[model samples]
Target: MTESSLSISVLLVCRDSAETSLITEVMRKFGISVRHSVETEALELVKYQKFEAAVVDFNVPLASMILDQLHGSASNKTAVTFAILNGKSGRASSLKVRASFVLHRPLSPSLMYRTLQAAYGMILHERRRYFRCPIVVPVTLQKGAESEKTSAHSVNISQNGLAVSTPVPLGPGTSVAAQFKLPQLPPTIAAEAAVRWYRDGKAGLLFLSLDPSLRSELSEWLSRRMEAFLRPVQ
Candidate 1:
């Protein structure tokens, strides 16, 4: 679906019927429509539905199997998957799943809402970048005496640079340093860059000095992030 036409479909799997109701209520408060299901049968149903996202129980029996199936089915479609694990036994298992985010059980409604919004924003940003050229990265600018730190979330990236989301506003011609950790990659790279433009909490940075290896690493991470958006539906 186009980014502008996108709508969120949340699959909420819970063992307790009462908890399912509470989860559904929270989703509605955020204006998100959700599909409530028992853990046992939710996996099969999810395979056939075109949900934009899923929220599942981490401790449910066959949870791994369900996650595996979902992973296989995700194609060219970015669906944010979240696992809710309350008990100690489920912690390790939840970590093993390839979910975008995981939450401990005894769910906090506010936290859940915020997490959902962030995930959705990430997915939306990815989709927009894939379809349009010159993806804008969101970045926060923190000025220092000698240099400025441009903290950015590399939401979308290309060979030129990346789109980043930051915590602070920046202006044109601002020289800054950017630091971010790539998913599944070690050793964060700090680069000298200059802000070409700025908007609210988002800014575009032109890397001043970056080695070939660092650029290649950033390209690989960008590819993986883009691939997540282009994954097909199973």
Candidate 2:
């Protein structure tokens, strides 16, 4: 995405009424957008939606529920979460659960800013590696080490990769050759791509090598998509 379009939006799940507003203000002061609500509403949001990153007060009543629902077991994980460690019962045990980062009480502005900065950095890095924009295209996928071909549908295309839902998932880091046609283009786009990630039947493919001509075509396609993204909607 373009610099103007890129933003860091985090889910805030703190219960301290004063600190909740204060935290939101702090995020805005750092130029990071924050989405927050009452503890009840926030819990509901985390249950069904994923955020770029989530900052949560692990001391709240619904904290564990949020974690279990959003960052659960391996097959159910969604978003990276940062929890504030409050010294309460079961706090130490909760440490066993997965969290991007955890901090103790008595927060400072600089510390908070830096923490979120880290979270944003992590999010951006993940995006660069596997982030995708919406697109639909048919792809003929062939594993680099295998001769079998699999039919797949590209759901979103990104700078480094594309997300595809196929009948079978290509193992992560497996090199592959792909042939596909993007919308609004004249020629077929083909590249040596590597499977960067996979879950269920969907996988992310990172283009490892793009010849000059194909690179030029892909760049043009990306530029067009970015322009459309920047265009104001009616």
Candidate 3:
């Protein structure tokens, strides 16, 4: 799948009204279309609908209930799941339930976006590895000088940077420009990146000029891609 081809569905459950608004606002700013549902509805929806990932507020009263539903036998168990930890609970306990990632309270939009991107990227990377695709996408280090375009393929992607395949590998300190096309969105949205590494068609590119809105759009695109990929191939 190409970068533009990505789409994601996120389930946001929060007991605190302020937190909910903050999350929704960030997602909206990024142009991530979301489905707002109560905890009960969200859990049931997970059984049938395909969501790229889910964001749950572990601070809510129903947090444990939601967790059980996510880990329950009825769950499809494919979508990536994230929990917002208030720091009262131990990470060890959360890890046991298979929460892919956790975020602490007093959240920032940037942090939330980055965490989600990382979790999703990790999930996709594992899937691709399991399928053994000859081409792997990189998930980190996607920014550098604009003059020189380096050849690379993404091993995985996040809002910040992407892992790429590099030719004429350089060392860790080396720098260059990175360019690649995302799948569905316009090629005009191509990422201008900075090279973070150089090694055998594999390197990192940090996005040079992505803002909150662009990040949201990218998130939405990834969510959609996840749904499409998880769908039964017809």
Tens-place lDDT digits, model 1, residues 42-122: 767767666666777765787666667666665424667788777576677775777889877677678777776677666
What local lDDT score does residue 210 receive in model 3, on the 0 to 100 scale?
A: 60
The deviation in Å at residue 158 for candidate 2 is: 2.9
Off by over 4 Å in 2: 1-6, 29-31, 73-78, 87-94, 128-234
Estimate the TM-score of every prediction. 0.46, 0.51, 0.45
Question: Which one is best on lDDT?
Answer: 2
Q: 1-234, model 2: which lDDT tens digit per residue?
A: 443234445688887877677677766654445777657887677665545667778777777777776665332264667787754654676667567887666777777777766675565443333334577789999885458888999978877778888897678888989888887788887889999899999998888987788777776677566445433223
Alpha-carbon lDDT, every model: 0.63, 0.70, 0.58
Ranking by lDDT: 2, 1, 3
lDDT of 2: 0.70
Error (Å) of candidate 1 at residue 214 is: 35
TM-score of 3: 0.45
Q: Write the per-residue lDDT of candidate 3 for residues 1-234, one digit (tens) a residue.
A: 543234345677776777778777766544344566777787677666555556787766676676666656343356567788766455656665557777776788888778755664655543332221123543223335443444555676665666666554656644444445466645334555565666666666566756566667766666565555544213
How many residue pairs clash (N, CA or C atoms closer than 3 angstroms) in each of the candidate models, in the order given?
16, 0, 44
The 10 consecutive residues of candidate 1 with the worst lDDT sum are 129-138
